[model samples]
Target: MASYSGNIDYLAPNGVKMLKGIDNDNPERVYICTPLDVNEIKLERHPQDPNRMVAKMRVNICPLSENYKNVVRRSAQERGNANVSVPTHEMQMSFSVGYIKSVAQKFPKLVEQVKEANKERDPEIMGQDPTDENTHLFKAIRQRMNKRLAMLYQPQPPQQPSPYATPNVGVAGAATGYVAPAEGTDPLAGFTDADVGDLPF
Candidate 1:
């Protein structure tokens, strides 16, 4: 019930390919990769299509890992209540635009911030009881737009030097486990060999 003609500004000149498959002996595909920065991406209502929208990528920032394929199969016993099962791939064939606008795109950062906030989770400032909904751990998850990312991420303990790591040494030193003497230390203090070398008359 609408009319329009021309290039849609909301579509990238070269849109991203989010999926690939075979159709009619020719390769077929879909375009729906997540933009790194939402502010750089634009979604505009289509002119002729009332129910459709155009997503344009203002810049290219897609990473390699997001384009790979992973398949998963869950057995009925693992699923807890299912008698039927099918393997699911990494990307969904059909995606809801409204849900994309409201939830999916906003989810990754939400989890990141919650993880960041959980790093600062103190039972004293929040609550001591694990069941208490007033805790920062519980509250941060509910607050979707929480900017608690300023909280420090969990720090990993420093890795100790590997016990099996090879030490630098000459061939003989390696076999004998000879450590280089430190500065100001005698190098030949432990030598028990005869120092008189062919000096007999």
Candidate 2:
């Protein structure tokens, strides 16, 4: 008989379904994980709005701190499953394209890592046009250029706005924010982390 390792459901405060992204309640929690695979990043159309685009990727993270490990264990135990082992490896994380870009800008090394991974996965990627956003490999080049530019110019602190100033409201893109689907929606909903191992992340 084939053994079954069942899905472990991790809950946030108030039993809200915690799927792919980092737990909002524990913003400081840290995890150890490998670099993203070459096929990890993907461009997809937004589920709620057809005109918009969102990049959906899966991130496998393992709790790095002992306290966090215990928390994961406790969460599993609270689910009434003594047999279910704490998932110390391959916890799912989600990121929007904008967040990814921000990370790249802050940590320029990440852009190089992506490029190296792409070349390792397919040598042809090295020859692809860097400006093309249609392919994942070239997208990394674009991100790399952006990272370089960001490094060239350090950001200045934002100025306080006047009380009488009209706030600017911009349309949403994969450009900013953590989640993309909608409020209270999980990008990784309806699928276990194992299910999306080959999908994204």
Candidate 3:
């Protein structure tokens, strides 16, 4: 039986800290243990600090042979698996941190270089002459602003009244003043107790 192990630091809400330990007897069935419940998981930034955040997750364990067989069957059903063979243990474990430390260490430097190149490609503009009151671009922008102001001041037009503003005569014709009933009017009006009749036996 092969064995694997690793550790991961995960942030949690309400200033809670979570640390996970991964352990597996077979490469495909890794077990991840943490303090968080599998349900009610949430991902959010710390209330006091925006830069830090919590990421919720769930873990699963599966047999290596079963996992591989399922993958092959899925591919065959979906895209026609071409009878490709699975990788050896050594090849499968090549992604382990012990095997890829040097590559990982250079990631930060590569990110910094990329950021510097991006900055150079989109350099920021500074005011020309440092001491001059105004530059050519500034004067042109000011003149365009004045022309826009003059055009805005010259506008003159009145809008017509809407057709819907008039009251609907057809609907208004249906309504009439309510009339009070005369003194001897039947208290029950058109209804009779016979409508309710006798209860069924």
Candidate 4:
């Protein structure tokens, strides 16, 4: 099993909220959302016990809702902005050896990616014992994990811009299907019952 040496305890200073009424069977409701950014992992002295070290990382994410996405798109269009970003918040979380092992089991491809990144960053990591905390390879693996997480969670925007604008496809064609939103109406007015999901980083 893959593992790290640092002690870690799960901590969410400003944790994501659990979906209110979905998945009643789950005591801990876990939802899927999009992560905007994940800061590089670092070892910090434990806040409660300075003598011990723990892994820490910052995650910025927004809850997933079809209506929320639509609102973002609509707002961007109103401002004539091409690039759009979802409303996001930052949260702090910790990683432990158990987390690494679980990731290695369920997400082996991630481990493989880390190995490749480690080799590119420091070829010596390929030969060093990964289990040893004193070795650079250990730190390299942690950094690689950060890289993989960022790639996996970052949101991907639309390739084409049709949804933002009704292209000039002749006057008759444009008028055929375009119905502009009200000047001062709630973008999410009709999506009050939309299912909101939490992004697990």
For each candidate in turn, the TM-score is 0.18, 0.24, 0.16, 0.28
Query: Relative to the unseen true structure, what is the C-alpha lDDT of residue 133 in candidate 1, on a scale of 0 to 100?
Result: 51
Which residue pairs clash within candidate 4?
none
Tens digit of per-residue lDDT, candidate 4, span 5-44: 2212222222323232234454344443212122224456
Q: Give the TM-score of candidate 1.
A: 0.18
Question: RMSD of candidate 1 to the true fold?
Answer: 31.9
Q: For model 2, how many clashes? A: 2
Q: Which parts of model 2 are misplaced by more than 4 Å?
A: 1-5, 9-91, 127-133, 138-201
Q: 1-201, model 1: which lDDT tens digit per residue?
A: 322122122222222224333223434433233332222234567889977768543321111232231111244446574433231111111212332233222344443444555666543433332223555544444333221111111233445765644323221111122233355543223322243121110
Q: Give the alpha carbon lDDT tens digit for every residue of 1-201 in model 3.
A: 554332222221112322222223333332232222112233567789997767543333223465766675577767766653332211110122221222213233332332344444433212232112254322222222121101011122434855633322211222233343465543223333342222100
User: What overall lDDT, based on C-alpha atoms, would model 1 receive against the true structure?
Assistant: 0.32
Which segments of model 3 are wrong by more than 4 Å?
Answer: 1-39, 44-51, 66-80, 85-201
Compared with the true structure, all predictions reach lDDT values of 0.32, 0.42, 0.30, 0.42
lDDT of 3 at 76: 72
Candidate ranking (TM-score, best to worst) = 4, 2, 1, 3
TM-score of 2: 0.24
Instruction: Give the Cα error of residue 99 in candidate 4, in Å.
Output: 4.2
